[model samples]
Target: MGKGAILGSAALALVSAARSARTVATWRTVRPLPEAPLDKGKVSVVIPVRDEESTIDGCLASLRTQRHSDLEIVVVDDASTDRTVEIVRQHVAEDPRVRLVRTDGPPPGWAGKVHAMYRGVAETSGEWLLFVDSDTESAPDLVGKLVAAAARDDADLITTPGRATVPNSGWWLLLAPTNVLLFDTASPDGSRGKAVGIGHCILVSRAAYDRTGGWRALSGEHADDVAFATAVRDAGGRTRLVDGMDSITSSGLDSFGAVWRSQRKSMVAGGAMVGGPAAGAAALGLGGLLHIAYGVAPVLMSLRGNGFVRLAGLAAWAAQAAAHRTYMVASHQSGATAVLAPVANATFGAQMLDAAWRSVRGGNLWKGRDIR
Candidate 1:
């Protein structure tokens, strides 16, 4: 090989090594909080429900069996047209711990979920606030573990990655990996110096919530969890991510169309918050293209019989996949999926492009609302 080729390879290797070191540092710095056995402080579980009739029953049923006896359940019905309210009311009637609150509309500049969450928090009296989704089913000890984790780590906020129950469809196998990839890239467990948190199952101390100005502070933010965590961290509060896969399962996302629409809406909404539609779209487009190019280069190099180029490409791809798989398995994904990690990474890259283009054209829609 020429000296110029060797120098280029050496530079690439150095960059790769630096990225790996950063990922390792992230994992070591942010360890999972230890599990709490029971709710030591008064705990309130808040669930914001919309048209979740299909899964609300199972979610409430699971909550009813929670081992945290001292906890209260607050369900905010966000003007659903389905039987979601009825199901929640039934659960409320059966157990005094569960209360139902109704909201007619989201206030200006506030997303529906954040508006509902504010109402739920206002109606509950607990030292700890747990914001859970209506489409999620929790294990009996889920609340206890979250509370325990919070206390053990002195975390101001705690979030978990739940199992994504994708429907049995080819689209799901192809696109579902984007969610995992996002978590891997943005989460502290996967990358260093990256702010990370998921909204599905977030636990915040009442003090921390109040100090950060609660949901009202994040009222205008589309990615409320990320905004809230950033606020906490900026205020010198600690946040931790926990493994909630076995403790909670999500309703199966059954349609490819639904996944694409949902993701597009989310990207647009989040993008809008960071920048206007134009800048956000451009950022997503550029990032997506780079990711896809990197992912496909290895295959192209190998096919061309360029051993040096192929080796470099393969190493880069493997490093990226390994980092992603580490985050997935740590979050409780099955090892079987790890074997398909490269495929997942590539799919994620493709989805980013689709989402960005859809967002720019104002094609993003969700829950009967056009986020863009």
Candidate 2:
């Protein structure tokens, strides 16, 4: 390799090593799920659905068996064209704790799921409220455990991370870079300027939620979870992201197209919400560049370069893979996915660029709604 090539590879190697170190450290601080059995509070689990027939039943099946005896499950339907409502009706007849709530749909200026969530909250009277996506499933003790963690930590709102299970190994490999990247950087508490939230499993106290203005405040928001968490923090309430990987899972976004749309929507909407067009665009660009450089560059150099260039590339790739193992294990993903980082990074970088383009050019839709 030329001197220039060797110098560039060595520089990249150092950058990846540094980034990997920081990523590993941040993820290491994420508190694990509480193991000790604890007291259960009166909790209401609200599931807001539009057209989720394929996954709602599995979600309910997971909730109904909750060890938290003092619990009520409310499945709010927002005019699902499919059998989502009918499926919930069957569960309602069987489980006394489960109730079905119907809503006409969101009024002007309100997002669909946000409107349903608002309506669902009105029908319940629990000290704690859990807003779960219809595609997500929780372990029996999930509610009890989160409630306990919240109480012990004085947190008013808690978000448990659950990346929907990717069905195709190849698709998952494509997604691995972004997943590990996010898992490494997301704040475990709402200490950042705006908290990034996991929509599928949000646990919040009714008191704090009401004080923060609840879903009503986020009626028009496409990024409702992040908006809600930000509201909680703005109101002086504590919002935390806890480790619920072992207890929560979701069967969502099964196809590559679904994955692409989901990522784009969040990137476009989340960036706009946080920093408007310019800052968000800049952030996405920088992040995409980093992911590509860290994940893809080294692998290429390792594969094609000679001598020191190849060695530096190999070292960087090894460092990133080792750092990524911590997150993979925490999220229950196969650690072997780390080897696919190059493909994953390229996929993530492309998605981010897509988001940036859509942001400036306008028009990204979700369920007939223009999110960006």
Candidate 3:
């Protein structure tokens, strides 16, 4: 048994345990907002659509069946060259509560989604506004529950994380924990206490939104959710991040390319939090440690060591695997995906390097627009 292998195994095990504890401590599960009726305030759901024809109907259907009665759905079409407009129009015709608006295009310096949300907000009037992605399908009580939770906590903004649905591929599972970690760090409990709003389903009071400068304030940022949360927190507004797995699910990934593109975009945008390229490089080094220590080191030790070293390596690997499994289950992913932890860690390491490269190069393309 080599001294180095034993030391490495101990360190890796400790890291895995610490990460698992942090995830558990930071995880915020969503409960039903309240048991009250919908007489509190008028709620407006602002959905930004862009070539989401396939998923638009289901999303609209979810909104239509909301338990909350005083709700208006505003769908902002970002010049979709598809049936997105047609689908939204159909909903508008059938249900008076749904309205469709179009955006000419995002002006220079404005990200597409942020621009669409800004336009949607302009066309709708509601005491409470919910910005939901077009691909997300909400449960009937989602809006009511979120509104009630915000009111109970006296929170100005509430962001809910959705369950990821990747029916075709398991590789996409790797990206799930990235969000869990991000959500943990982005919430008030992280080092910065900066509450980052998850874009899939974010609910905010109109007054609190205006206090943080609203969509206009996040116009130039590539990652509007995090930027918006930072703004809200800066303005002394209470920001809450909750679990939306029961209330909403996002099935946007149909291919590995989709997974890659989404992960790349997030990594690039997330670099803004730590100081751009330099921070990304530093993070890459740190991310590499997980794969090397937990995945590669085990294999090397088992092959090279005599007895105790091999056992230590195996134990560390098991610890990491268990920690990863717990995280997957907590994040509403299939627990079976934990068996693929090594692959996930390797992919993450590669993605971190790729993200650093993209950050150094300025920005990447998202939804056919450059995010810089």
Let me know the TM-score candidate 1 reaches against the reference structure: 0.87
TM-score versus the correct structure, for each prediction: 0.87, 0.85, 0.85
lDDT string for model 2 (229-275, tens) is 87888888898877887788877766777778777887887777667
Model 3 agreement with the true structure over 1-372: per-residue lDDT tens digits: 568767866776566566655555565343434655344788999998888989999999988999887999999988898889988889999999999999977888777888999999998889999999877898888888888878777788888767766543434345544644564456542236567677888888899889988788878677778778778878877887766677788877546667677777777766655675677656755765554445666566556756777776666556556656766666566667665565566666676666667666764357665554
Compose the digit string of candidate 1's lDDT tens values, residues 70-132. Answer: 889999988899889988888889999999999996978888888999999999899999998
Q: After superposition, which runs of candidate 1 have C-alpha atoms over 4 Å from their true positions?
A: 1-36, 165-194, 252-261, 336-340
Whole-model lDDT values for every prediction? 0.70, 0.78, 0.73
Q: Give one clash count per candidate, in the order shown.
A: 1, 0, 0
| Candidate 2 Cα errors over 4 Å, as ranges | 1-11, 163-167, 170-175, 180-185, 253-257, 274-294, 306-311, 356-364
Clashes of 1: 1
Better of 1 and 3 by lDDT: 3
Per-residue lDDT of 22 in model 1: 49
> How do the candidates rank by lDDT, highest first?
2, 3, 1
- Looking at model 1, residue 155 earns an lDDT score of 77
Among all windows of ten consecutive residues in candidate 2, which has the lowest summed lDDT? 167-176
